[model samples]
Target: MDEADWLAARFEEQRPHLRAVAYRMLGSQAEADDAVQNSWLRLSGADTADVDNLAGWLTTVVARECLKMLRTRRSRREEPIGDTTAEPSAGDHDVNDPEAEALLADSVGPALMVVLDNLAPAERIAFVLHDIFAVPFDEIAAILERSPAATRQLASRARRRVQGATPPRQVDITRQRQVVQAFLTALREGDFDGLLAVLDPDVLLRDGSAELTPGAAGLLRGARAVGAHALAFSRAARFVQPALVNGAVGLAIVPRGRLIGALGLTFRHDKIVVIEMIADPERLRHVGLAAVGP
Candidate 1:
């Protein structure tokens, strides 16, 4: 009815898009919410009487906040990464609620989030806006304070890495689930050969690359080594269940219905070629594993 009420209503309308932008930029639900809140604080304090496009203005504000947050997160590289899960631990948002579930699922997937985390703050801003949300390069450039050409380049680099991390493949979801289930069943039964049977002879198990702990293994070549590691971690398999990882059927390690981590499997010729396990608490918490679980 009044000026303040009209402004509040306008902000509420763009809140979803703002949160989505912040979530993709920051990769944490809490941080995303914080970024959105920060944007509102800025808008409330600033004079937006002359601002023609409130939507674009708010997006830029939220993006700037997210960029600052990303830089802060990167500075504390030495700090132990806390466990992040699809289920926002804040408890303010109920996972059982469909609206809450939609927000949780918006962060691509846990595995992709980890890769996106590796990108520099600006590159992430560029990629997430242009690649994920289809924001124009010129608008993103203004937010990053870089030339449109530079912003486009940043998005290109980030896109290449994202595409590289997740090699494009037409995976059969049903068959992949069966393979994952078979592997898990064998793992529980301690069937080493059975584990090898489901895996490619040249299977790759890439445990850690910038995730939870500094001591995580980089890569394990050959089925035997991969199987041995699988057996070693088999005790945790009881908690694992079939789920989608980056749009493909994989497994989520949910102990007591809490998402601990996710495994992204790459299948070739009906055999597992790559197994990427993300168990770090910080990275795990941001992933939407809880949303796709059994």
Candidate 2:
């Protein structure tokens, strides 16, 4: 084969890994695909006869492209974050497909995606490369144009935000997670008894979404009433995942990679006493949401 054909083959081989890296950095499949395509363009034009690791070189190129896109996105923050813009759909390939986006969201995890969106461009790049992909700090330092120590600090800061420090509060968080997980599991499985187990006898559920149930309206009182409503809308459980709502364990309703709503839970004596559904676009954009786990 000719040199061009040889390079094309190599580029095709690295496309998957490169796309994965870009997706983590940008949190959008279409943007990630664009970044990877731009990287291929750079590779086709550059002379890499002396380059020992082609994968590393291509990764750096993709990273730079994603960083530019992120900076541009930050500058163009005209609309609110969770205003429910339609996802782009074109060809049959995974990049623009809604089903593919849902699968990717499930794999990388909705909570992580939500948290990564809140990170700064440099912090996101540093944390994803060093912590998630296992890239060296020195290499990441070069990407950020900072010293190795500084790059490490960037990742450290992101790490603390993502994983959180294990203090006394952590114990409470673990207990909360257990209750939330059980609540989710029961709701999804349609286990009425299980739902009652995690719910307090006098549980209160307040839903802010416009489409409130007929009689229930905005507020639901008592465990039996709340459990019944949960079963009625249990289909939404498929899109829900555990997340940190204002520094406590809760649920994030992410569908097709877009965070439409969140369930902020308040617990008392190992039971969920209050479940507030925040679906108002204004509240979703401003609420403090993050990944709940490492």
- Per-prediction TM-score, please? 0.53, 0.49
Question: Tens digits of per-residue lDDT for model 2 on 1-294?
Answer: 999999999998677678668877886544776899999999999999999999999999999998888888889862112211111121222465554444334334545666677778899999999987788999999888999999999999998877762222222778889999999999999999999999999887887675456776787888999999899878989999999875568899999979989887777688988787888875465356778873
Clashes of each: 10, 0
How many clashing residue pairs, candidate 1? Answer: 10
Question: lDDT at 148 for candidate 1?
Answer: 98
Compared with the true structure, what per-residue lDDT tens digits does model 1 show for residues 90-127?
A: 23345466654555463465456667777899999999
Model 2 scores a C-alpha lDDT of 0.76
RMSD of each: 9.0, 12.9
Candidate achieving the largest TM-score: 1
Range of the 10 consecutive residues with the lowest summed lDDT in candidate 1: 78-87
